[model samples]
Target: MVEAARALFVREGYHATTLTAVADRAEVGHRTVYVRFGTKAALLRHVVDVAVAGDTAERAVAERDWYRAALTGRTLADRIEALAEGTAGLMERAADLFEVVLQAQATEPELAEAFQAGRADTRGLLRRFVESARTDGLLAETTDPAWQEETVALAGQAETYLLLRRTTGWAPEQYGAWLRRTLTHVLAAPLR
Candidate 1:
């Protein structure tokens, strides 16, 4: 049902998509969707969450191998590269649906709140990474971890990926490489 909702929401846009249509696409009864998810907003939120989480319940983004590599990398460049690689994959999976949510947020108060909440959550994750880098002495003495965290969060956003990939015709690999280089230059400790 979540997959079905994702497809329909992407294809039809938020206002155009209906619980009945989702039911039809999933080959389930309308009442079943209402029973399972309770509301259209709830269903859409679930779909977005699942899509961002890579459609899995077993592990979170922080627990994923790529994320672990980013955290455990021996050098700042290696950490940035791993982080970019993981972010690229996640953006590829979630960018379109994330755009949908962003657009819908203008008209749906609940979706607007959800969008802000998601942004805050992402910022928190980036802040944690920045804190870890600071703890590892991989950041310059002048670097502000909060500022670096916000910068990295904005730089690694889905909109940036969508712009570079869809507008500028950069492939995912190119995007990842550019992100890694850019972030490395911005966040890496200076060479003595």
Candidate 2:
């Protein structure tokens, strides 16, 4: 049933996905879906959670490892490749559910809370990573607000990859490579 709802939610945004459609997709009765999930919003949230499937936390760890490597003067290319690989894997797994989650946040306040909570957790984890890097003298100082913004903006690269996937149907590795190249360019230290 969760898979069915996830499919419908991805095919047609959260506002349009209905219990009846999910029921049809799942080959179950509408009453059964409602009994199992309670509400459309609840069902959608469950589907999103299933789609996320613990990847967010794993991705956070990957990001920390990549950034820590960068601090050691490792080539930005290598770090970007690592970051892109981790992001691409997670994005591919959660793309459909992520679409539904975005739609749900746009349309439902209750579901938005869950989405916001996830966002906050990611930001908090990033904050910890940056703090550690600062203490290790990898970053000049953590006082700058832009340090936090940069961490959050990494999602922009993932969003761009999603757009390219929809338009060009590129393989995951191809997209990851492109993201790595772009990130390397953007993240390289300023010249003296």
Q: By lDDT, who's the top model here?
A: 1
Candidate 2, which ten residues in sequence have the lowest lDDT sum? Answer: 54-63
Off by over 4 Å in 2: 54-82, 133-175, 178-192
TM-score of each: 0.88, 0.64
Residue 170 in candidate 1, Cα distance off native in Å: 3.7
| lDDT of predicted model 1 | 0.82
RMSD to true structure for each model, in Å: 2.4, 5.0
* TM-score: model 2 vs. ground truth: 0.64
Clashing residue pairs, candidate 1?
none
Summarize candidate 2's per-residue lDDT along 90-116 as a digit string, tens digits.
567677676667666766888889877
Model 2 alpha-carbon miss at residue 166, Å: 7.0
Candidate number of the best TM-score = 1
Model 2: how large is the Cα RMSD against the reference? Answer: 5.0
Error of 1 at 142 (Å): 2.9
